[model samples]
Target chain A: MLVIDNLKASINGKQILKGISLHVKEGEVHAIMGPNGSGKSTLAAILAGREFAAIDGGSVSYFGRNLLDMAPEERSRDGLFLGFQYPIEIPGVSMVNFMKTAINEHRKYRGLEPLSASDFLKLMREKKELVEIDSTLTNRSVNEGFSGGEKKKNEIFQMAMLEPRLAILDETDSGLDIDALRIVANGVNKLKRKDSSVIVITHYQRLLDFIVPDVVHVLYDGRIVKTAGKELALELEEKGYDWIKKEAEKTEESWRVNPQ
Target chain B: MNGNICQGGLFTLQESTVSENMENDSDKILDEVTSGDYKYGFYTDIEADQIAKGLNEDVVRMISQRKGEPGWLLEFRLRAYRHWLTMKMPGWANLKIPEIDYQDIIYYSAPRQKVAPGSLDEIDPELKKTFDRLGIPLDEQKHLSGVAVDAVMDSVSVATTFRETLAEMGIIFSSFSEAVKEYPDLVKRYLGSVVPYTDNYFAALNSAVFSDGSFCYIPKGVRCPMELSTYFRINAANTGQFERTLLVADEESYVSYLEGCTAPMRDENQLHAAVVEIVSERGAEVKYATVQNWYPGDKNGRGGIYNFVTKRGICKGDNSKISWTQVETGSAITWKYPSCILKGDNSVGEFYSVAVTNNHQQADTGTKMIHIGRNTRSTIVSKGISAGVSQNSYRGLVKVLKKASGARNFSQCDSLLLGDKCGAHTFPYIEVDNQTAVIEHEATTSKIGEDQIFYCNQRGISTEDAIGLIVNGYAREVINKLPMEFAVEAQKLLQISLEGSVG
Candidate 1:
């Protein structure tokens, strides 16, 4: 469903994602694990078309179309969803109104009629139940004064509302207690389908335990140096990232020698 | 006295341009706003009894003589004219007032009606059409829901509907001229009670040449059955509109009055100096609302209305209440501060305002709350929105006198800036002489967050509609205070005024 080849990206002249390559097929859940400053979030941001980072080299293809050429909103309309690590707080903009505009816009892009008021409200209720979002929270300004748990859950609620084909959860487990983490992971698990895919980017392997990934990739120094199955997450968690660091260093030395 | 002084310099921080492209974007947005047609710019083809372009004691007298006022009224105008000559134009506001050629402006320009219309049908069809185009229904049968309209064209009250119906309830609603002729006692008693002739530079000028406005009086113990509204239109060229509106709510009475103004597009800036005085007696309540949409000059700020208006209400009896709600979205240079004087014990005063300026429009508006009686309370909620190189300031004063024991006041002034070139300022002055008084003031300044815009854009709403929604939400506190029909109109006006103000 998504493919990235040798994605070289930088922000403000500092190369963040050096030479990264990844691919995900339909219905497969991929977990990208990395330590701090390993460019895990940068990959998610680049895929979502955030303009702050410059793509120096490489290509990201989504459903056989070049995703980098599209605007951020167009990417969203094209079924690319990024769950922000830190959700934006939009004061005076109710979540209900925000979701309505987003849903209608996406429908418009797909040549579908907008939802009626009753149907929209019904959809909101159904989605709220999926994520356990409070009805009052949906009426309030989007994430304004929301608790950390509420914000993460709201993101999932929005993901349910949009029903994107591919969803990238960036550090969704951060700032969430164990209960919230379980609820968020459960919500994502329910939204999974045979035609949809999920990319879970996290520094910790805790989130993967709830929404178990089929493939696990360790990103180090802007490159994915290790790929394995669900057992890799448990092995890395037990051994910590020190082993991964030494392996990444050896790979870097070999790449320098080979000049590939 | 020290607390009454607001300490701040206007335009202290120079805005830094982020990029040439951003500057160009702002200019393009402003161009879009200015390109929109001024829907109320059409003029009536009626001949006017226009006085020569000049202002002096003699000109003031001619206006009084034309109105055929009593000697006392003429003397009042002459006194105000003399006082105006001695005073210099006030430069305290954060505005650039291009030296107004007072002598070059025609002080009086009344449309020459062949005969005074006795009813709506007798009114000139062309004049009625002008109001119709402005969306002001003058025909009683087609009036806005329950709003009784007093349509003022040029410098005269053209048609006043539902007058007889209101008169039957002892609610005297008529033109200022008619009031002066028939109900002279009420007109003379409260003409300048709240805002006196010598209140300020503009008030003095308005007093000297004030041609026509609405006069409403709700009798004792009576509640006005319908909304009383006055629509002022400036249609003539080179004419300075000076309208004076007076409203009085007798003991135990209640009334809600609305004033709306608009002027046709003009190259040379036309002056609109108006004075509105309101009085609320014992146990009486008065709510005054204004939606001022004067012609704001084009992108380059070439032409528009120089709106200098003085509006105030006095709570003269115990338990009286007065509220001023204004939605100001136009005018090139607006200097207005509708205030309230809480003079009676336990009286209440409120000022809710939303001032929007775009495309070189400069507005320095707020309100004054003077607490003179014990337990008197006031609340001020002001929202200022500036876009496109415009400047919007909220300068307010809340004074608690020595004898105003237990007086309380709460004020919140927020500014929302749309672009880098625009500016927002707040200067709140608070004074308390009594130790028992409690006052709280909060102010905040915020720009339209880029993240907020992106969030909206990602959802499918266009940048323009997103800004409209955000701005309406910001001003909802003040706009919600408007009457039901006016609230919808105010929201639409805010959207139109801020169109293309954001990228």
Candidate 2:
């Protein structure tokens, strides 16, 4: 469903993702793990079509379309979703209104009529139940004055409402408590289907226990160094990222010496 | 007639067409320049009786004589004119007042009406069509929205509805000229009680040559049956509009009044100076709302209205309340402050305002609250939005006297800037002589961040709608105070004003 070939990206003349390659098929879950500043979130942002970073080389293809050529909103209409690391707080915009606008916009993109008010409200109630979001939270402003746990749960709620084909959850479990993590992971697990895929980006191996991944890749120094089964997450959790860093350094030295 | 073209159906059709085009290709939506022309820029063709260009004692006398004012009213006009001559135009406001050639502006201009219309059927068809084109449903049958309307064109009242029903409840609803003739005692007692003739430069000017405006009075213990509304339109060219409005709420009565204004587009800037006064007696509550949409000129700032208005109210008796709500999204230059004097013990005052300036428009508006009696309270919420190359400023004052023990005041002023070229400013003056008073003021300035836009765009919402949503949310605190129908119209006006303001 998605393909990235030798994708080289940079921000402010500094390379963030260099020659990164990845492939994910339908119904599969992939996890991209790395230490701080290792370009894990950068890869997620690039896939989301964020314009902050420039693509210096290579290409990305999604559903037989050039993903890089599309705008952010067009990418969204093409069934791509990016769960933000830090959810924005838009004061005065109620969560219900925001969701209605998003749902109607997606429907418009698909050449479908907007849902009626009653139908929309019923859908919201259904999704709220799936995500365990309180009714009062949906009536308030979008993410304003929300606790850390509520923010994460609201993101999951939005994901359920959008029902995107490919969702990239970037650090969704970073600031969540045990209960919130369970709820978020459970929501994502239930939303998964045979035709949809998810890319879970995180630093800790704790989240992998809840939503098991089919493939785990360790990213270091703007490149994917290794790809293996989900067991690699346990091994990396037992031993920190020191071994990976040393290995990457040796490869760098050898490349400098060999000029390749 | 063109009124059919300006109906609600046409607006809905246009909106659907835009969204339909947007669905096919969302990428080009951002690049598309979706600016809309002014909808109320058309002029009405009518024979007018206009005074020669000048501002002098003779012109003022001619206006008074034409209206057949009593001798005392003429003397009041002369006193204001004499006082205005001694006062040079005050330039303290944060406005760039162009060299206004007062000698070149016609003081009085009224559409020629041989006799006053006794009913809606007798009103001039041309004038009725003009109001219809402006989206003001003046016909009682077509609009049973429970809003009594007083439509004013140029310097005279053309039609007023629901007068008989209100009169049955001891409420006096009529034109200022008619009030001067029929209810002279009531008009004389409360005309300048709140905003005196020597209040300011614009107030003095309005008092001197002011022609016509709505006059409303709610008698003791009477709650107004419906919202009292007045629509002001400037149709004649080279004419300066000066309207005077007086509203009085007797003891234990309640009333809500709404005012809206628009002008025909012209190349040369027209002047509009107006004054509004309100008096609330013991246990009475008065709410005044204004949606000012005067012509704001073209994108390049070629022509618009210079709106200079003075509006103030007084809580004259114990436990009385007064509130002012305004949504201003028009005028090339706007300099107005609706104020309240809390002279009654335990009285309350509130001012909710949303001021939006786009393209080349400039607005400097706020409110003033004076706490003079014991245990008085006031709340002020002012939101200023600046888009395109315009500048919007909020200048307010809150004063508490020494004898006003236990007084309270809370003020929140926020500014949102859409583009990099526009500017927003807040200047709040606070004076507290009573140590027991609790006064709080909060101000914030925010720019529409790129991240916010991207976030919305990632949710399948286009940039234009995202900006509109963000702006409406920002001004929701103030817009929610307007009446239901006017709230929707104000939201649309906000959207239209900010269109094409972003890249």
Candidate 3:
């Protein structure tokens, strides 16, 4: 359902994603593993339609349509979701109200009437249970004064409510404790359906243990250097990234010698 | 986001055109008006019967005679006008108001539309249509149901709505011009009673040539059923809007009054000196709110309104209370302090303000509380937001008189800086003549941090929404103090007023 070809992207004249290509079929989970500053977050931000980024060269297609041509809100209405590394605190805007707005906006874009107050509340209760979000937190301002774990969990709860076709989790497990990590991963597992896909971007292998990926790609220096199965994650965890760096250097030297 | 709450229905095409025009005109005017000169200084070609500027017995008498006021009110105006000559412009205020050409101001300008509407049908349609365009609901050929409004154009109140309904409740709500004519006894009894003629230069001037304003009196034991409102607009050039508003809440009575003001852009700065007095009797509560959007001079500091206002509330009877909540976002130079005099034991006074100054605007606004009775209490919350080379100062005074032994007060002043070029200063003078009185004051200043906006952006929220959220949060403490209906309106208003300042 998603296709990216020879995707090249840069922010502020600095290329971050260089000649990366990927394809994800429906219902598949793909994990992108990289060292620090491997353009993992950059990929997520580009998919979210953030401004001030030079495309350089890219053709991203989602659901057979040009994804780059759509606005951010339109992309959201098209069932594209990005779970931020750090959630925003919208003071005075209650969580219940925020979710209601988002849901109604998406519904409106789909030519549907807004949900009734009773149905909205019922759905909220259902999603809160699925994600184990505290009742007190939902009634307060959106993510304001929430702990790190609660914020991550809130993102998952929102993801459940929206039921996006494609979900990109950007470092969602960085700040979570063991318990929170388990709860978050469990929530994601419950929401996953045969038609929905997940892209897990992370620096560590801890998150992959809870939400196993169908295929894993190792990224370094703004480009993917290796692609492997889920077990490759454990291998990288034990061997560290020094081997990957040495191999990358050797490849570059051979390319220079061959002049290809 | 609630579809049910869209009472106004779809946005009108006319509204969009007006919005576009407002943007273009304001930008063009802002460019020309940046030099602190009024762009709307030129007058429209309309013949107006106006009294000469400069306060004196003659001008006061002329204004009283033009309005056909009673003999006692004319005498009162003459007396106040005479007393005005003895008072000087106060120098103690932390304001740098330019020297006003009082002699050049046309104190009285009537549109020749002074035929009182004996019945609502007699009202002119054009004037009624203007109010309709302003989003004010007025019944066809009758008064509105929920709100009583006094629409003042130039220096005179053209019409008043819902007078009969208010009168049925024994609550007197009418134009100041009509009050002087119909309720002369009440007007004379309380006129200048709190702020006398010699109170200050502007108050004295307002008392003298104040052509029209709103007057309200809530009867004993009766709560006003609707919000009392007044819309003051300055249409004529060189004519100052010196409107006076007086509200009296009798024993066990309650009332809420709201006032809004606007003016066309002008090239020469126009003077707008207003006085508002409120009195609460025993067991009474009075809330006075103002949303002032008068024209602030252009970014270059050209023509704008010089808003010098004196608003004072008197807690006269035991257990009485008064609250002043103001959201001031306009005016080129503002020098205002809505004060309260707590004289009765156990009386309460409160002041909540959100003053924003942008693009060369200057505002020196705060409040004063004089506690005289035992167990009296006062609270003041002032939020000042300054941006784009503007300057805002909060000058407050809290004095505990010698006999106010058990008085208490708490004050908090917070300033938010949008740009580094702007300035926010607080000068709080606390005088404790009574040893047993308790007084506390807190002040803080903050800027819109880049990290906060970045966090929101990472969540896919736009930059404008992020800035709006931060502003709304900073102003929640004051916005929540407003009535529910006004709180929503104020939130939207803050968003509109602070547009383009976030980036």
Work out the TM-score per prediction. 0.92, 0.94, 0.84
Between candidates 1 and 2, name the one with more favorable lDDT: 2
Instruction: Name the regions of candidate 2 deviating beyond 4 angstroms.
Output: B1-36, B501-503
Which of candidates 1 and 3 is the stronger one according to lDDT? 1
Kindly report which residue stretches of model 3 are placed more than 4 angstroms away from their true locations once superposed.
Answer: A1-25, A35-39, A50-74, A107-119, A240-260, B1-48, B53-57, B69-99, B138-144, B297-302, B358-360, B386-389, B403-406, B416-425, B433-470, B499-503
Top TM-score model: 2
In Å, residue B216's CA in model 1 sits off its true spot by 1.2
Clash pairs detected, candidate 2 = none
Q: Report how far off residue A233 is in candidate 1 (Å).
A: 2.3
lDDT of 1 by residue, A1-260 (tens): 79999999866567878988889999999999988778887788678764546689999899999988987778888888888787767766678778888899899999999999999999999999988878899989888788989999999999999998999998899989999999999999999989999999887888988999999999998889899999999989999999999998998899899986
Candidate 2 lDDT, B112-141, residue by residue in tens: 876677788888888888988887766887
Best by DockQ: 1
The sequence of per-residue lDDT tens digits that candidate 3 reaches over residues A1-260 is: 88988788766457878877888889999999888777777777678775435688978999999988876767777888988776766555677766776788779878999999999999999999998888788988877788989989998998988898899998899879999999999999999999999999887899999999998988887778888889989999999988988887787789789975
Global lDDT of each model? 0.86, 0.87, 0.80
Candidate 2 recovers what fraction of true contacts? 0.48
The per-candidate TM-score of the B chain, in the order shown, comes to: 0.93, 0.92, 0.88
